[model samples]
Target: MRAFDPFGWLEKYFSANTLHLLIRAVAVVVILAFLIHRISLYSRYLFKPLWAAETLIFVIFLISYIIRINPADRSRGVREILIPLAGAMLPFALIFSPSQNLITGQTNYAYIVFIWMTVSTALTVWGLWTLRRSFSITVEARELVTGGPYRFIRHPVYLGEMLSAAAVTIFRFSPVNVLILFLFVAIQLFRSKMEEEKLGHVLPGYIDFAAKAFWFWPGPPKHQR
Candidate 1:
């Protein structure tokens, strides 16, 4: 009789597809749990401006990532995965950082903070809305999205995230905070490059789509023009 090996049994029982499905299910559960926590935390400030926008972005994220087409090409390398993960976690640094008051001329910071956060959050929400089912953190290609802000720029989500990071950095201004913000933006841009490469490889039209708009700035998509 052959000796039983637990690892062999696990491998035999868990096919790659099954393992992937299980991992994704676990990820969804964790994300939903976090979303619930965030909602509970923010519920107290429901009357506050941009209240729904705060959670809406994350909800859209969960939806897009969960209910999406399988990737034609995906980066499963540890570096690729960690890059986006690091970028995502960088903004959380602001949660513990101390904020400083800034008095610019006669304007109070409340208006500035409100306007800045609102605009940035709106941009993020708009991008997420456009992405709907295609947006993801990892570098992968699903369906191409060319509507909404994608018509304006290649990566509105990253721009919005950077803007949000900037606002938070400003709120808690410090040398270390600024460094973290810059690092976050750099990672985002790097991830965009990887995404562009992967998309262009998997989707033939991505080249033309990229040409339609600048990587960071606004321009018309080819179909629109």
Candidate 2:
């Protein structure tokens, strides 16, 4: 049997309007990334404003992530960049070999958002619960946490952030929304990974911890092939 053409439904929306939306969406994502990088660069100097804005934004992201528990967040820096780029590319691509199902009035990929939201939220709570004491943005961090979610996944909070951000994009199902979300995911992912590398290098038993926990998804380490 031939492989199913999952993206075949995009045949119906091959118009100029969709193309324009896609181009604009791509532009928006690029702008967001540039702005975020600049903001992060000087956020320390403008701590109050940056912190306030990101806190509110992340809180909203957290709430959305928690709403869904089964779906999983597959966000990483690559995914963060790809999602918006994909949204932008979708219009042109769909014109020839489409993937979305327009007749249903729903994108074929919406289910992924649902799954990711639930998974991300669960991981976030778990990570927070595990590292209750070490949960500060202070430079000299407190003692390492090896409890709750931390015991299972090394970076549950990051996972949650990625998941939630991606979920929001999928739910909105718009070019602009997806683009903004992609940039947020990319920046946070970079920040988290850098922290993880630094912290893992310092904290004792980190080598063992690294050996055990998965980087993104929260669970027992998968068996090596």
Candidate 3:
């Protein structure tokens, strides 16, 4: 009946209006498409990378919203959107789950979530923007992304997106939300394997980059040193 708003849940932790839902939505779609392009050769998974389960879930959410919002279909609905809503909300909405009052009751935690959301969103925007010209969503991915945040981090945007979602989970403090994040992490790891194969075959510098860069997460392990 109500839309899930993660930023609203974290309003206590940081000032309101830090996260822009509309822009963030656009960013998600763009990034998903970009990542999907890397694994386009797979062909069976709707050109979806193995790690794009979150994007798939969001796409389903978009479809559900379309069904709910269409005035003509509203009356002839096959099923209420409750189940899909719960699945979608479980990832980020749990921060305000049970009730928003319970979360706002702890202003400090709320503030922390808000701040994390704000910082993560800012990094996402900046990182994505830095690669704007180099960004692509077609089958042909970038040759290399060493210019911007990519120089320091192979997956800065992914990290930022994960952080933003994590902030939402912290605000909600739901076990189910943590589970979804874990699922996402697993998907990203799988996608990394597929991407490395693609890059090694097509892109020139990828192997060297992989040698230096951490796959999904950042930072080299002690053993690497």
Worst 10 residues of 2 by lDDT: 67-76
Clashes of each: 0, 8, 7
Best by TM-score: 1
TM-score, cand. 1: 0.82
lDDT of 2 by residue, 1-225 (tens): 113221223325555345434534564465456556645655453224433433433343333323312111112243333333343333222223222343225534555544555566666756755554344321222356677777777767767756666655545556665666666666555555545554545555655666677764332222311
Model 2 residue 205 CA deviation (Å) reads 1.6
What is the clash tally of candidate 1?
0
RMSD of each: 6.7, 18.0, 18.5
Query: Where does candidate 1 stray beyond 4 Å?
Result: 1-13, 43-47, 103-107, 217-225
Please provide, for model 1 over 62-176, each residue's C-alpha lDDT reduced to its tens digit, 9 standing for 90 to 100. 7865775555654466445767888888999875777675623325774686578778888889988998767667666778888999886888888888898898788778898
Better of 2 and 3 by TM-score: 3
Model 3 error, position 46 (Å): 38
Per-candidate TM equals 0.82, 0.44, 0.50
Residue 104 of model 1 has an lDDT of 34
Question: Each model's C-alpha lDDT?
Answer: 0.73, 0.47, 0.49
Could you say which candidate leads in lDDT?
1
